[model samples]
Target: MSLDSWAVPSNTGSMELTDTTPVHLIHVDPDVNMARFYGIELQPTLFGEVSVLRTWGRIGTNGQAMMVTYDDEAQAADALHELERQKRRRGYVPAGT
Candidate 1:
């Protein structure tokens, strides 16, 4: 898939300076969350293939989002559909009204 399509509003919010260190805030996309539930890690391969990466724990959290790299647009679309299915099964609702 083209990077343009995947590009969306940064889930991570604006950064802020803290008393001692700088803090970076982030937001999690529901679709990405669902992918994690299915044990899929979207990463780019050396050959420029965007596929699922194998991992032990969840790849993303509440604020941070995970990205899935695909070899082509078709694969990306399929992966997205799978994520949606998982989300539906888990009864997950998107953030905001």
Candidate 2:
């Protein structure tokens, strides 16, 4: 099968703050009532490893966002794929209306 141009492409949004390229962001709310949110954002880095940001728990109450760095691009890609798979398994869809 072929992708429709938005299948896991680079992320483009206000969430990206630095000049590093954005990979993608996956935000899933299992409850969908601000009860909780599971989100991830892949970002590029010039020096050091790629950045993967993860956010979970209640959105405005108990949610937490953290960033972890990988040693290389391949490792980062692998992590991204693994995360996407897990999110899909949990019925998490792309964010927005």
All candidates' TM-scores?
0.34, 0.54
Deviation in Å, model 1, residue 62 alpha carbon? 7.1
Off by over 4 Å in 2: 1-34, 60-62
Whole-model lDDT values for every prediction: 0.43, 0.62
lDDT of 1 by residue, 1-97 (tens): 7898677765432221111111122234666553332233344445645554322224354333456676654585467556645655665433242
* Clashing pairs for predicted structure model 1, backbone only: 11-27, 12-26, 50-69, 50-70
lDDT score of model 2? 0.62
Candidate 2 lDDT over residue span 48-79, tens digit each: 56778777765465568788888776686677
RMSD of 1: 15.8
RMSD of 2: 13.2
Q: Residue 39 error for model 2, in Å?
A: 1.7
